[model samples]
Structures are given as C-alpha cells and as structure tokens.
Target: MKDLFHKSLSRRSFLRYIAATMATTAVDWFKIEAMASTVEPKSDYPVVVIGAGIGGLVAATYLAKNGFPVTVIEQHDVPGGYVTSFERGEFKFDVAPHYTLGLSPFLEYLGIQEKVELVKPPEFFRVITPEHDLILPQEDPRGIIRVLSEKFPHEEQGIKSFMSLLNGLLQEWVKPFDMKTISSTHPIMWNLSKLNTAQVFDQHFKDPRLKAVLCIFGSGFGLPPSRLPALVFSPGTAASIYVGREYVKPCGQGFSNALMQAIENNRGRVILKTEVESILAKDGTVTGVRTTNGKTYTAKAVISNASAPATFEKMLSPGHVPDSYMAKLRTYRPSHSYFLVWLGLNKELRGKFKGFQNVVIPEHYDPEDDDKATSACNASKTRFQVYIYDALYSGYSKPGKSTVKILMQCGYRPWKHFEADYFAGKKEAYRKEKDRIAQILIERAESKVIPGLKSMIEVMDAATPLTHRRYTKNPEGAVLGYEHSMDNYWIYRNKNRTPIKGLYLASAWGSPGGGVNPVVRGGQSAFTDLMLDWAKIK
Candidate 1:
C-alpha cells in the first residue's frame, strides 16, 4: 500500500489513464447497442424473472420494451423487495434506502422520472463523534475540502490528495469497462483494489479522528474501513461528496412503483404475493419456474433476483449446479443486517435539528471496535444512522408531526434463536427481544442526537434480522448481499451469467454488487447478456 502511494502518478498521467478507460467504455457501450439492435425478438421466447427487486424490475422492463414477453414474480405483496415503504398511523416510513445515488438517469431511462420526486438533503450528511460535530456539504467537493481542512489543519494536504484520488476513482466507476482487462489497464485502480479502505487511509493521514470521519460512510456498504475494499469505498464516498445524495419523496416505495408501472406500460406482467417454489430445469438448462400454488410459467429463460444461496441450493434441484460452483459459493459470506426502529413522532423535528435529513452518530472514533460491537450485539458500542423524513421535505407526515428511523449494523446470529418461532407466526419471544434492543437504540439517539425523542413518539415499530429475512428472503437478512471485502470484491464474485445456460442472476447477489445504483446497472447488464445470447441462437 505504501509503495503505491509513494509512486503517485502526475496529474497529466492520471488524466491520460482516465481518458483511455473512458474510450474503452464508450466502445463497449456501442458494441452492446449494436448487438441489441440486431436481435429480433421472437414472440414465443418468453422470459421469466423471479423477484420484483429493482434489478429484476429494470431487467424485465428493458426486455419487455425490446419486444420480448416478460413476467415478474414476487413473493411479497408489494413490488419492491427491500425498497418498499409502510404506513404507521398518519406517518410513513421507508423500509430501506434512506438516500440513493445515480437514480435520476436510471428513472429517466425507464421514462418515469416525472412520477418520482427526489429531494436532496440540506447537507450530504452530518457526522457526530465524541470530539466533533461536522456537516459535510452537498455537491460541493471544494466546500468539503475546506470544512475538513479547517477541522484538521495539519492533514489538509493529505485530505486534498485523498479527495483527488477519490474523484478519479468515481470517474472510472461511472464509465463502462471491459471487465476482463480493467485491472490490467488501470494499474492504480488495480493496486488500490487490493487494499482495504483503512490501509489506504493510513497511507495519507496520521490522524485517527480524520480517518474515522472519512470512513463513517463505510457503514453504507455494511463493512468497516478495515475490511471494505478501497476501490468500492472511493467511488461511493466521492459520489456523495460531488454528486450529492437524494431521498425519494413519499418514500422508496414511490420509486419502486414507478419502475413497476413502467414495466406494466411496456406490456410486461408483475405477479405479486406469489412465491417461486423452484426453478425448473431439464438437461442442466433452465426452462422456467413453478410458483407455490403449483402454477408453472414456461419460458425460454429465467432470471433469479433472489439471494445466491436460495437460487443455487434451494430453488434448483440437488446436483443441478456444478459441485465446484457450490464449493466456491460456500466460501462467500452474506453481509451484515440491521436492527431498525421506525418512529412516528407527535411533534416535528425539523426545526429542532435545522432540517437535516440524515445524521450519523458513532459511539467512538474507532470503526473496527464499533464493527465488533455490532457483531457481538452490543448496542451501546455500536454506531447508528438516524433519518428524519419530515426534515427532508414537508408533508411527510400529518401537520405537527414527523417520521424518523434509526438503524444500526447488526449481526444475524443473535436473532437466529427467534427465527423458527418468528417464521411460524409465534413471535412472542422475538417481539420481546426486538423491543429491548429498540429501546436501547432509541435512548442512545435521544441522548446523543435528539433530545426528548422518546416522549415525542406517537407510534413505534422495530424490525429485526428475522423480519428482514422474512420479507426480502435474503439469507440472514444480509442487506448488501455478500460481504464486500478484498477477498470477495465485485470482480471476484459471480457475474450476471451462471454455469447453467439460460439461467441468469440480477440482484445484489450478482456482480458489481449492491446499492440501488449498481443493481440497476446489473439488471441492464443481465438483459444485455441475455439478448446477446438469444441473438446467437439462430
């Protein structure tokens, strides 16, 4: 890591590298479009997509628009897997995704931009630690540099260098790439990809507090800086600083609804409240899927947006997947889940907090220790992110009221004991445990960020890992799919294509891993690959 940092390239060399990568990306995009235009859709070549998550939805919409018959099957009553929202009395709360990046272009591509309203937070996010309270500016990299430089004057030059590196990484991330050669062609990116975020920070700064400040966003990927891939961390953090973060109006459900509507308008079908019992295959090739009600949907191909474990181990018949594939799958672990508390406050919190949409309060400056506490189920030592809905925009709740959500990274092992009973609908013990944890999180928030938070609550709801698993069907309720460590980086993980022909993956479980933005691109890439495959069938 030190060697790479010591040999930093000149600014001119960096620009030249970026330009080459962008040109390669443009060529790849044109190739995809040319292939897509040449493929003639067959009326009988129907496609079945399992799960109505953003990835599956985007893929189905593109296929349907391109003249192939498409059908989406979802187990939940709603369309969005984890992106849906719920109502509590007069207040509404988003289930997951407080704010998202790269949604505008995606929505516009689906032609539903007008239907969904995205509101930028007053600031990117507010970070609070024992020693400092800082607000990072939105869409202003120079402002961010100024703020951090002022806060940590001694590390100003280091901050500037780090930000410049992140900016370059962000440019690379947004463009297309020839995945086969990206590592070899982009040496800087390749070198940094081998190190964790913490290792990269050590090369630049001497202040632990500054490192902590820069790394708090790692929680968005469900890992601490010590374990998160520096390549993955750079693009996301840079996007937040330069492009800014936006919250969906009403809730994330509105965004999901827009995509669903786009699919329907394009003559696609979205089946809800129906579980896919198994993926039908004959002679080691996917045929279609069978629902829980014994209804069979025959198609030429199938795309599974379900968790990888469920897709390979449970959905398919035993021995259908190759032994080596299953062996590799076993080595990958799911990312951490969350313990969330959604509150419908009787009084508005906008004025009190000065209209801040998001606030992150860590227990201390050490993320590694905080991660350990999370894995150990120690709420006192864990950090939490608070989302104030009313603060983002007005009319989020009834007059004189507001909605807030508190979330913390939580391990699934502690909630395993309640899994059986919770699934069987006997949730007494599960509810008791969840309530206890919720109270601890609420009290921590009240003491650290919101004063008298408990008293203002009109309705309170808490969800455990079991709840997330039950709803999303992600094993252990892993929010970001597989752990995004250097060992399991995107390039090393499974891509959209699978060992079995005609069967594809489009979800957080697939390549270019999680986050609404990456998954959307994953969906598009899956559709592109599927279409290319079909074009060759003649």
Candidate 2:
C-alpha cells in the first residue's frame, strides 16, 4: 500500500498533503489561535537556527509547528550536514554510515514515520579478520552468543556475561532521570559516567578476540575503548545496534529532503547558501544574526548546530563569551574523522559478499593503537568497513548495479596542509596525494577481502578530512563532535544553555554525542529548552 502511494507521489508532495490534511482536520485551529493570541507577541522572527544539519532542522520544524516564527541559515547548498548523500552517474552513496537505529521514537515524536520509509537490513554486520569471519546478528543477544560460542566453544560463558552487560547497560541508560535533582553525584548515572569502555571490557572478558570484536563498537563512534566513556559508548551504542530493529533508507537524501519538506510544511523558512557571519547579541542576550551575504536577521532566540568551537570562537566576539567557557571549549578534545572511498559497481555484489556491512579488521587489531595511528593518514595502518547498499536496498544503484562505500579511520591533521597548498600553486601535489591514497586503499581492499573489487568499480571518488571540512565547515574536520570520553559525559558534556541568554547549542558537540539520530534528539532537547523559555515569556 505504501509503495503504491509513494510511487504515485513524491516524499515532499506526501508531506505537504499530510500538512494540508492536518491543517483541515487533525489540528484544532481554534486552540492554536487562542494560544497565539495569549502568548505570541507581534515579532517578525522569534527563533533563528544556524546550520541546517539534522539537529537544526528538527529544532526548526518543532518550533514552527508550535506557531513560532523561525528561519534557518545554512552555508551549504543543501541540508543534512554530514547526514546527506551524493550521486555519481548510476550510483548514489551516503557520505555517512547508511544504517541507523532508534528511529521509531524519533519519527513518532515528529509525527512523520508514516510519511517516510525505512528499509531494515537483514543482520547487524559481518566482521572479517585474518583468522575468523563472523556475521553478527541484530537485536538478538542470544543469537550472537550462540554464533560466537561456535567459534570459541570455551568462551561461551564469557560471551554470555558480556551480552548480559550490554543489555543491562542499555536498560540503565533508558531510565528517566529527574532533571531537578540530577547532578554530578546523581546515583542513576554517576558510576557509569566514571567508567571507561576498556575498563569494563577488561573486567568482563578475558579473550582478546572477543575484546577486539567489542572494541569495533567504539570504532563506529570514532573512539577507542580506552578513551570512550563506558556509560555513553556501551549503552548508547548497544541501544543503537542490539536493542532495537535497525533500519536505513536507500540513501540519506530522502531523509534529509523529508526534513526540509517537514520544516517548510510547518511554515518555517530554510535559507541555503547563506553563511551566518556572527551571532548578534546585546547585554548577553541573543538578538539575531548577521550573515556573510550582508543581511541581518533578528530573532528572540538562536540555536547553533555547528561545532562548539565554530559557534563560540568564530561566530561570536570574544567579549560575548566568558573566559572560562572559552578555556573549556579550547581544552575539550574532539573525536577522530573518517576517510571515505565511494564506488559504483557494474552489478550487485551481494551474491558473493552476502552482507550489508562488511568490515575488514586486521588480525592484530588494537583499539588504542589504531586510534593513535589514525592521527595520520596511512592506508596500511587503517581499518576499513564496506557497505553494499544493493545487498538489501537496490534502489541506491541502477537496475543491475550496486553502490558501495569504504570508510577508513582518519585524523584531520594530515590533510590540513592540502588546503593551504592548494592556494600556494601546489594543487598537483594535493590531487596526487588524494589519488595515491585512493589507489592504495583500493588495492588494499582487493588484496585483503573483496577480490576483483577494482575491476567492478565504474565510478569512484574519495573524501579526505579536508574534503569533509570544506563541505561541512567542521573545525579540524572533527565529524563526531566532542570525543565521547569520561571527561565529556553527562555533567561534563557541553550544555544547551550558554552564558549568553537566548542562545543554545543543538549539535553533536552537545550531550549524547554525534550520529544522525543522537543529533536529531539533541535538536529535540534544544527545542524543549526553547519551549521552556517561551512558557516564561510575557
């Protein structure tokens, strides 16, 4: 039924249809008008969101739905920030990981799940090492245990204990906390916040291979076990992968487009290619923003979806932010970025690969060593994960073709010089370095796991840290925002509220860390803060 309806109408059209339908039927116009009359002032703009990333878009949509006049300013020509897609000939590939978990609640909160389609991949992922190849199942701890036990019969009890911990931690995180009483000494999350990922794993499992498998979970968040906070990494990542039905769209474009449509349907404005030069404020209260295009927009409040450093250091004057806050932002450690290689194949490779996500892990995989090694670009030292969209959803590629993405761990410092060199008449060297790295990665994949992968590639493009920085404007190309370490969890994480009144942050830099779903939730949290302020207004 959904396929037929979607076939007849586009996602944007369907969103608009629902918006019109709700306006006429579902919503009580009288109550809305009464609320507006009682609370809303005669202001041209009440909220201005900077950066049209998922977080900013979600916030804008929610505020606009509640009758607040909102405008979103994005420097990119498109929305979604890192959660976006691109097309090359017959292929479409997602820049970020294609699979996402914990969507139902978020979609339900937005009341748009019915308007969007999500494709669930068959399993979690396939982990390939030199000695073992294991296919991990999703949402089934027992199944995972059974499979791992078959590989190492003696460690069955260890596997069971680890699985129990994963599930237990997940439950602990989902428990609601009382905001009024929540503090550093809060019983609910204090111990978890103090624990690191490696410490918990070492205490539970003795098998090195088992520990390696678990460490990969932290890699997904761009952290190593030693540095990753147990509370944030264990429960958050487990909830995402093992506690729910996992799903992904054909690509991220539809999801991004749908959010944009939802915002417009709610009467919010999204201005693309307009860079916000500085956040306007007076007496420590947000007034509006000035854009690079020489236009000033006024609003009662502001939400920043850009990185914390970008928001505080670059977008505002030094006087507007406190020295303590500036020092904190400077000292806060950012997470590792990624190097991606996108491929368009002639035909579906799933018959041989047989998995949606295939990871090529080194036999001597050490999370701490790999995490340190990513500080520089080296193809041989890097681990790679390959995503075959055609394995589950064929729409990402043409009729018989497939779309594959290879993501490698990388740091921003190695490619930092490329940008400077480009302007200094050394464009050839920059291009050559990127091409050389791409070729090396391709060869490495072909030799290690997927043979004939080079011949299958019809279109290819590579993105370094510099490429990500160029497009997303993330300082230092830090894709996952602040590092999810012991020091940056719960009370230590950046809060939505700033010292400046009417200013808030809704990005990966804030609490709960990065990823499409978490950032979307971050946006929702920011919206709640905005609503509280609105409730207190005259």
The model with the greatest lDDT is: 1
TM-score for predicted model 2 compared with the true structure: 0.89
Worst window of 10 by summed lDDT in candidate 1: 1-10
Report the C-alpha lDDT of model 2 over 1-538, residue by residue, as the tens digit: 0111123333344334333322222234354344445555635448999999988998888777777788999999889898788778867778888455646555665677766678777777688877788888875556777788888787777766666666554434433455565443344355556678888887777777777776766676777777777777765555545533354565676777778888888888999999999998888988999998789999888999988888888888879999988888787777778888998988667676767777877756776667766677777776778777777765656777878778887988888777787647677888898888888888877776678999888999988887787888887778888876667765577777788889999898986568776677677767766655555674
Superposed Cα deviation of residue 116, candidate 1 (Å): 1.4
TM of each candidate vs. truth = 0.92, 0.89
lDDT of 1 by residue, 114-203 (tens): 999988888876887777788888877778888899999999989888877876665456445665887866656777878888889998
RMSD of 1: 4.2
